[model samples]
Target chain A: MIELDVTKSHVLHQWKADSPLIACRFSPTGDHCVSTSQDNRLQRWNIADGQKVVLEGHESWVHALTFNKTGDQLISGGCEGRLIWWSILEAQPKAIRSVEAHAGWIRGVEISPDGGMLVSVGNDQVIRLWKTDTGEKLHEWPAHERHIYSAAFHPDGQHLLTGDLLGKICVWKLSDRTLVRTLDAATLYSPNKGQNAEFGGVRSLAISPNGNEVYAAGTHKGSNPFGAVHEPLLLRFNWADGALTKSHVCDGIPGGLLYRAAALNDATLTAVSGGSSGGILLFFNATQEKEFHRAGLPSLARDMDIHPAKGLVATAHFDQHLRISALFA
Target chain B: MSNRARYACGSMDHALSRRRFLGASGLLGASGILGGVASLPSKVAGAIPKNDYRVVVFNMHGGLSQLESWDPKPSTNTGGPFRAIATSVPGIHISELLPKTAKQMHHLCLLRGVNTAEDDHGKGAYMMLTGRRQTPAAEYPQVGSVAAKMLHDDQTGLPGHIIITPGGGGGRGNEAAYLGPKFNSIHLGGDKPPQNSNKPDAIAQEAEERRHLLRRKINEQYLSQRRSAITDAYTHSYEQALKLMERREVFDVSKEPQAAQDKYGNSELGRQCLVARRLLENGVSFVQITHSNYDTHNDNFNFHIEQVGEFDLAYATFIEDLAERGMLEKTLVVVLSEFGRTPNINLYYGRDHWSKAWSVAMAGAKIVPGAAFGQTNKEGTEVVDGQVDHGDIFHTILRGVGVDSSQSLIVDGRELPIADPAAEPIWKVLV
Candidate 1:
C-alpha cells in the first residue's frame, strides 16, 4: 500500500509527454498515472519508475478519461467525441471498443464509484450514461442550454452532477434519471462573455463525498468579447440545503481562470488553467476565507485528478509535463 | 416604426470629422476631383456600364484560424477539434464547421497561401485592405474606395461604396485618404433605416422637399466661389449622403418575404449579408461587411464554431441568392482577414497571429470555381509553394471585378499603381 502523508508541498514526480497534456488520472492502485495529450495519445506512466507506455487511438485531442473500478479497463473521450475503451490489464494496452458517443467534442467523462456506469458530457449539449461492462448506452438527456462541460458522480453513486457553459449545475438522481435540483452557478461563469464560443464554461466540477455539496469552477469576470475571463472562480453549493454557500474568486491574480476543481476534505481544490498566462493550483476551504495551499504551474493545467488513497494530485499541463504533488504528514 | 434596424450615417461623419476636425485638402490627390474616374482605363470604362461588375468583401476583423476555416490540418497537433470535409471539388477540402460553404465550394477560389509580412492587427489590416503597407508617407484608399473611384456611376441613384457596420476597429480611416471622401462609403446598418432619412412624422413631405431645394440653392452659391477639388469633395460627399437618404428604403428588408430573411439565418452576419445583397442588387459598386471578435487568444475551437457557424450559413446563402439572381457572374465576393492563426497552438488553447500561409476565399466573376490554389507545408507552418502576398491578393481581386490595377492615382504629381506594382494577379485563379 502507498503511504499517506500531509505536510509541506513539493513536486513528487513528473513525466514529460512533450505535448500539451490535457487530462490526467490516477490508476486504482495509485502506483500509476494516465494522462491524455493534445498529441492525441494516452500515456500511462509508472509513478515510481518514471517509465511510460503510449496507447494510441484517438485521432484528435483527448480531453477526458476514466478508469473502471478494477483499474484494468480505461475509457477516454476525445475532441471527435469518441469513447475508446482500453484494456490496461495486458502488458501492452489495447483499445477494446471505440464508440462515437457524442456528435461533437467530448468535454468530460467519469465512472460511478461502483464502476457499474459510465457518464460522458459533450459540446453536443447532451449527457449520456453507458454500461461499464458493455458499450450499451443506458440513458441520454439534454443537459444544458449550451455546451455541457464536466460531469461527475457522487461517492454513493446515487447522484450525478453536471455543469455547463451557461453556469448551470444540474443534479440528477441516477436511479430515476430525473433532475433533483438545478443550481444557477452564474458566479463561477462570466455572464456577458460566457455565451461567446471563445470562452469555456464550467470546465471542472466535483461533488462532495456525501453528495451534499458540489464545487464548480471555470472563469469569471469576463468584460468583453476579445479577451476571455482570466479570473478563476469557484462556487460551492450545498445541494441538501439548496443554497450556494460560498462563491470564491481566486484572488491575487488578475484574469486568472479555473479549469478543473475537486472536492477535498472540507475545501475545494481548483486548477487555474491560465488563459494565455500560466496555470496555478489553489485550495480553498468551504468558507472561502482560508487557503490551504497554492502553487504556480509552468503552463495551463488543462485537467487534473486526485489520488484515491495516497492524497496525491496530478496536473496535466500544456507545457507537456504531468506534475504530481502529495500531502505529507 | 421599429427603431431597432436604423443606423444614421451622420454618426460616422461626426466620428470622422472628430478625427479629422482640421480636414485638410488632399496633399495626395491633385486639385481635380473628377480626375479619379476619368483616369480609369478608357476602353474598360465604357464597357463597365454594360458590364456592371460589383464586389463584396467580408472582412473578418481579427485573424481567423486557417486550420479551422479553409485549411484543415486534421492529423496535426494544432488542428484542434475540427475535421475536414470534402468540398464539391474532388480534392479540395475545407473545415467541416463550414458545412454549408462546403457544398458551395464549386463557387469559390480558395487561396491557401497568403504571406503578408505584417502581423500586428492595425498594420496587417491596413495592408490587407489597401494593398499598401502602413506607411507614414501617405494613407492609401481601401479596396472599397478604389472600387468606388473606378466603378461608381452616379446614374445608379445609389452610393457607389457602402460599408455596413464600418466601426469594426480595422481602423478604417476617414476621407478615403488620397481618394477623398467622395469615394468613401456611406455607412448604414441595424434595425431601422439611416436615422433621420425619413423626415419626422411631424414634417410634411413638401416641407422636406422645400428644405432640400433651399439647401441646393445655397450650395450653388458656395460652390461658385470654392471650385477646388477640396470644395468639390465636400459637395460630393454631402450629395451622396443625401442620395442615400432618398434611397433609404433599400435598407428595410421587411419588404422581402419572411422566408427570404429566414434563409439567411437571422444572425447579425446574416442580416448584414442580406443587406449586402440588397445594396449590391441596387448598384452599390463595393460593399464591405465586417463581423467582429475572431481574436480567439483562448478557446479557439469553440469560438470558431460559433463565429464560423454564423458566417458559413450567411455567406453560403448570400452566394446562392446572388447566383439565383444572376448576379454571381457579375459580382465578386471575397472573404478576407488580417492574417491567419499560428500553426503553433498556445497554452490557452489559442493560436496567436500568423502572417505566413494564411488563406482567403473568393467567388464570382473571373474566379476559377472550386480550385484550391497554393499549398502550405505539412503541419501548416509555412507556404511551400504559390506564396501570394496581400499585394497579389488585391491585384487578383481588382482583376476579377474588372478594376484596372494598372490605373494610376495621380496624387500630387506622383503616380502610384492601383495595386502594388510588384504584385501580379494569380492568373490561374482567374477565368
Candidate 2:
C-alpha cells in the first residue's frame, strides 16, 4: 500500500517533456503510461525502466488519452479534434486508425469497462460514443450548453458522466443513449458578480473504486474579474442519488485549479492542478471528504498519471518538466 | 521657423514661398481662412516639413490577452484552448481566433516584446497613450494630440485629430491635456454634428448663414479693436466650424457603395473602419477607434474569440481595402492596447494583467510586413529579445508619417520631444 507521508513526498525523477503535457493515463497494470502534450505528440513510457517512445501524429495539443480494456491499444484526441487509436503492444506504438472526431478541442476520453465503446467529449460541446475496435462512430450528441471538459464511463459499463464549462454534469445510459440525470456542480464555476465573466469549469472527473461516488475537481473562488485566486477544489457526489456529498477544497498551495483527479486502490483521491504558477498535489479520502495529504510540486503540472503498484506519480509541468514523485519508498 | 511647418498646409507648398507663407500668416482674409490658411508660425516653430502622413489607432480598451491574439503559446499551460495558425507572413503565426488577420500578416508587423510595466487599466492606458509615466504635475498630451498639432491640415475644414466612440476617462484617452483643446481630438461618430457642432436644424440654412455672417462681422470688428489671442482662436474655430458644416458630407459613409460596405462587414467596427478609411481619404490626419472589453480577467478565451474575431475581419478588410486604394504608402494603421495578460492562466481559466511581455501590430509607414521583430520565451512568460516600450512605439508611428520624432515641443516650458525623449524608433521594423 502507498504510504500517506505528505511531507516526505519528494520528486523521484524528472525529465524534460519538450512540450507541456496535456493529459496522461496509467495502464491498468500500472507499469506503463501514455501521455499527450502541446507539441502534438503522444508518448508511452515503461514506468519501471523509464523508457519512452514518442508517437507523433496530432497536429495540435493532444488533449485526451486513455487505454483500452485489454491494454492492447490506446485512444487519444487533441486540438485537431481527431480521434487516434494506437497499438500499444509494440516497442514503437503505431497509430492504427485516425478519425476526425470533433470540431473543437477534445477535452476527455474514456473506454467502457467491457471495452466495447469509447466515449470522447470536447469543446465542441459534444459527447460521442464509438465502437472501440472498428473505430466506427455509433452515436454523437451535443451534450452540454458549453464546452464539455471531461467524460468517463461508469464502472457498470452502461452509464457515462460528462462535465462542462458551466459546471453542468450529465449522466446518461449508454445502452439507449438516454439522459439519466442532470446535476449541478455549480461550485466549480467561479463567477464575478454582475459580470457575465466566469473562469473555471468542471475540468476533471473520477469514479471511486466501489463506483458509488464521483469526484469533480476544478477552480473555485469568489467575485473577482481577474481570476487571480489560487484556489483549487474537489467535490464528491453520491453517484446513485446525484447529490453532492462533500466539497473538498484545497488549501495546499498557490496553484489555481485541480485540473486532473484520479481514484486510487486505497479508496482515496489524488488531485493535481497547475498553470503558470507551480502545481499542487493533494490526497483526499473521498468518503470522508477530507484531505489527508498534500504536497507542493516543483513545476506547473498540467496532467498526471499514477502507478499504483509502484506508489509512483508522474506529472507534466508547464516548465516542460516531466516529473515522477514516489508516494512511498 | 522650419521647412517642416510649410508641409503643414499647402501655404508652404512650392507654389507658396516661405516669405509668402509668413506674409499670409500675418494677415487674415476670406481666402486665408478658406483655401490658403496655415497656423501662424512662431519663433519656436522649427523647420519640420509635413507631408500628408495619416495614422489610425485602434486602442483595444481592455488589456488583450497576448497568448490568444498575437503570441499564442498554443497547447501550453498558458495558451488556453485556442490554436495558433499560420499567417501570410512565411513564419508568423497568430491565434486561430484571428483567421482574417492571419491572412493579412504580410501587412502586419508584430512587436511581440512590449513591456509596459504598469498593469492597471487607467495607468497602463496613460502610459500607452502618452508614451510616458503619468505625472501628477501635468497631464501629458496623447499621440493623437501630438499628431494633430504637428500634422493637422488647416484646409481640410475638419478637426485634425478625431476619435470615434471614445469611452470616458481611464486610458479612454480624453482630449488634448496640456496641448490645449485646439489640438484635441474632435469627438465624432454615434450622432452627428457632434454635440455643439449641431447648428440647430430648427433654423433655415440661409437664415443660419445670415446669423453666422452677422456674428462673424461683429467678431471681426471686436477682434480688429481688441486683438486678443482667445478672440483670434475663437474666430478661427468659428471659421473652421462653418467650413466643416459646408463639408458635412465628409463624415457620411452611407453614400459609399453597398459592395464596399459589405466588404467591411456589417458590425460597428466594420462601419467605423470604413468611415475611418473615408476620413483618411478626405485628409483627416489621425483617427482612433477603441474596441472594448479586452480586459479578460474572466472567460479570456471566449471573449477574445468574439472581440478579436470581430477586429480581425474589419481590420483585415480595412488593410486590404486601403492597400487596394493605394493608401498604404501614405497611411499607418496601428493595433495596440495598454498592456497584455499574464503568461499565467489563473484558476478562472483567465489570464491576469501582465505588463512584462505583450505585443502590438503596425502597418504602413513603410514597416516591414510579415515581420515579427521580437521573441517571447516558449511559455511566453517573458520577452527573450528585442524588448520595447510605449515610447519606442510612439516614436515608430510618428516616424512612419514623416514626423520628426526627435523634435521637442515646448510643453509648459518643458521641451518634450514629439516622441518621448527616452525612446528611439525600432529601425529593424521600419523600411
Candidate 3:
C-alpha cells in the first residue's frame, strides 16, 4: 500500500462533467475512475487518456457505487431505488442488468470482500444482500426504523456494519444475517426543532484495513438545520467491543457535513466535508480527536474515494468537476 | 384625510352609493369589531347565513420549494430525489411529498408559473400578502383585510378576518391600513380560542352585569356629546369581543369528533388547519392558516420530507371536508408562500430562495377545478408560459370569491384600488 502524507497532497487533475457530481470511486486496478452526476448519468473516465464513457441506466441520482474484487464488474444504486450492474473495463461500458432494489432512495451499496455478495441499505430501512454476478436477491432484513444512510463490510468478511439516519450503527454477522451488536454514533444525528425537522444522520461509514476499527461521518449540533448551521463530526469505533473510541471534528469548519470517509490504514483516515461556505478534505489520525491536515476545495464536495494503488483521492464536487489529488509528494 | 365620509362604499355591487352597510349596522361601532366589550341588544345580532361567501388562505411561511411540492422535475439535475406522482386529475402530477394533496387535485387548480420577483423574506411576504411591492412611502392592506371588508356580513357577529398561527399570541394585526381598524385580522394560536376570551370565575355574574350596565351608560352619555370613528371603533371592539366570547367554542378543535382530529393528524399544522376549518364554517369572511419554517438552506430534501408531509395530510383533509359539506362552491381556498426555493441544490444539500419561477395553488369558489395553468422549463429554472405575479394572484383571489377586482374604495377622499390596477386576474384559471 502507498504511504499517505496528506500535507504533501496536491490536485492532480480536474475532469469536467455536464452536471454536478454526487459520488465517485477509483477502480480497484487504479486505472479507471467512475462518477455519478445529478443529471442521472454515470460516467467512467480512462485515467491515462481521460476518455469518458457514459454508463446510463439509473432513472434518478446514483448515490452509491462499488466494484467487484476483480475490477471487471461495477454495481450502483440510485434514488429511484433501482440497482444496476455495469460491464467495467470494456471499451464502451454498458449496464449488464438492472433490478428494483429498494422501495426508496438507496443511500449505500457495498461489495463483500469475496465479491460474491453485495449489501445495500436505503430509505426503506431494509438491508438487502444480493449475488453480485446474477443480480439475484440473497437475503433481506429490516435493519432500522429510520432511513439507512451507509453500509460497510469488515475486512475479515464476516461482519457488516450499517448506519442510519438516527446515528445507529448495527453490526450483522454475515453468516446468519442477524444483528450481532448495535453501536452509537449519536453525535452524528440531531433533531432540529426550530424547523420541525430531524437531520444529521450517519452519512458515510468506513472500516479500517485491519478490521480493528470503524469510522462514521456526518454532521453534528444541527441547531438550525434549515439555515445550514452545523458542524462535521467523525466517530471512530472499536470493532471488537463496539465502543466509541474517538470523535474527530473540525472546529473551524462550521455548517459543514462530512459526507464521505475512508480509512487509509488502521491508524489514519480521510474525509471530505462540504457546507454553504465551501468544501474541505480532512486527514485524521485514528487516535486523535481533531483533523491533522485539511485542504480546501474550489466548491462543495459530495463524495470522495482513494485510489488503491497510489492512494490518490478523487473528489466529486458541486462545481461539476471531479478533482484528483495525490496524497503524497 | 378625515374629511371623507366614513360610510363611503367600495365594491361595484355597492358602487357610488356612498353608504357602508357595515357602518349603518352601528350595532357596536368600529371599535367593537376589534375585541373589546360594547353594549348591544342580543336580539339585534343577525345569524350568519350558511351561504355567505368566504376565503381561506394558507400562508406557507418561509419559502416553499415548488420542485418539492406542486412542480416536480424528477430525475433532472435540479429535481433532487422525489418523484412526481399522478394526481386525481388524471394527467396532473405533483411531488410525491404531497401525496395526500395530490388525491384532492381534482378539486384544485395549480398555478405553475408564478414570478413575484422578490426573494427577501420580509419583502417577499409583504408582496405576496399585500399584492404590491414594498415601499417606504406606502403600506398596502393585506389580502385578508381586503377579503374581510369586501365580504363583511353586517348581520353576522363574528370578526370578519381571522389568522391561525402555530404559536402566535392571539390578538389583532394592523393589516387593515385605510380600511379602518375594524377590518384588522384577529389571531388565534393553533386551535385554541382567543386568549382571555372567557369570563373570569373570580367575578360574580351579578357584579359583571352591573359593571357592563354602568359602562354602557357612561358610553351612551359620551357618545351623545361626541361621536367619531375613533370612539366608535373603540366602543365597537367591545361588542365584537362579546360575540367572540359567546361563540368561543367555534375556535376549539377539541370539540371536533375524535376521527376528525385524527384525520387532520397530530402535527401543529394539522391542528391549525382544523381551527381554520372551524372558523370558516362559522361564517368568518376571511381565514388564514400559517405553517412555518420551510426556509431550508440545509438538508432541503429531509426537511421538506417532514414539513410537506405534515402539510399534505392537514391541507388535503381541510379541502375534502369543505367539499363534502357543500361549502366549497361559496368559499375560495388559496395556498401561497413568500417565494419558492432555488432549483439549484446548494453544497449543504439545501435550496436557497428562488422567486423567478415557482407555483401556487387555488381551489373552491369560482376557480376551475382540475386545471393547471402556466408552465415552467424542464429544469424549473424559468417560467416558460402563463406567468403571473402577486398582483394578478390578488385580483384572481378576489374574483374567485365573487368580488369585483376593478373596484376602488373611497378612503379618506382618495381612490384606493382594492388590488393593483396594473395587473388583472388570472382569468384562464377562473370559472
Candidates in order, TM-scores: namely 0.91, 0.70, 0.88
Deviation from native of the Cα of residue A76 in model 3, angstroms: 1.4
**In order, what lDDT does every prediction score?**
0.76, 0.74, 0.83
Once superposed on the true structure, which residue ranges of model 3 sit more than 4 Å away at CA? A156-158, A172-181, B1-51, B154-157, B198-228
For each prediction in turn, the share of the native Cα contacts (below 8 Å between chains A and B) that it retains comes to 0.41, 0.15, 0.55
RMSD of 2: 10.4
Q: Which residues of candidate 1, in runs, are more than 4 Å off?
A: A1-7, A191-200, A224-229, A266-277, B1-50, B166-175, B190-192, B411-414
- The alpha-carbon deviation from the true structure for residue A77 of candidate 1, after best TM-score superposition, in angstroms, is 1.1
TM-score between model 1 and native:
0.91
- Candidates ranked, most accurate by TM-score first: 1, 3, 2
Against the hidden true structure, what lDDT does model 1 obtain? 0.76
lDDT (10s digit) by residue, model 1, range B78-97: 77768899988899999889
Q: Between the candidate structures 1 and 3, which one is better when assessed by lDDT?
A: 3
lDDT of 1 by residue, A1-329 (tens): 45533335457887798678888888888878899887788899888887889999988888888889999899999988899999876777999999999988898889999888999998898989999989899999886888888898978778898888778888889998899988888666553322223354787888776677777887776654245445777777786766888777666666567767776554445454566457777777765453556777666677777774677888888889998877544
Per-residue lDDT over A1-329 for candidate 3, one digit per residue giving the tens place of the 0 to 100 score: 67768898888888898988989998898898899998888989887767888888887888999999899988999988999989988988888988998987899999998989999899899999999989889999998999999999998999999999889999999999888999998888887543456788899999989888889999998766677778899998888899988888788887888989998767779999888658799999965789989999888898999874687889999998988989888
Q: Each model's RMSD to truth, in Å?
A: 4.7, 10.4, 7.9
Q: Report the lDDT tens digits of candidate 2 across residue range A1-329.
A: 55645446779877666665656777877767777665677778777777878998777777688888888888888767899999887988888999999986788988888888899998788888999999999999877988888887889877899998788889999878889998789888865422224457888988887798888888877344343444778898898898988998766444367888888664678888774357877888855555777788886777887766667788877666677888874
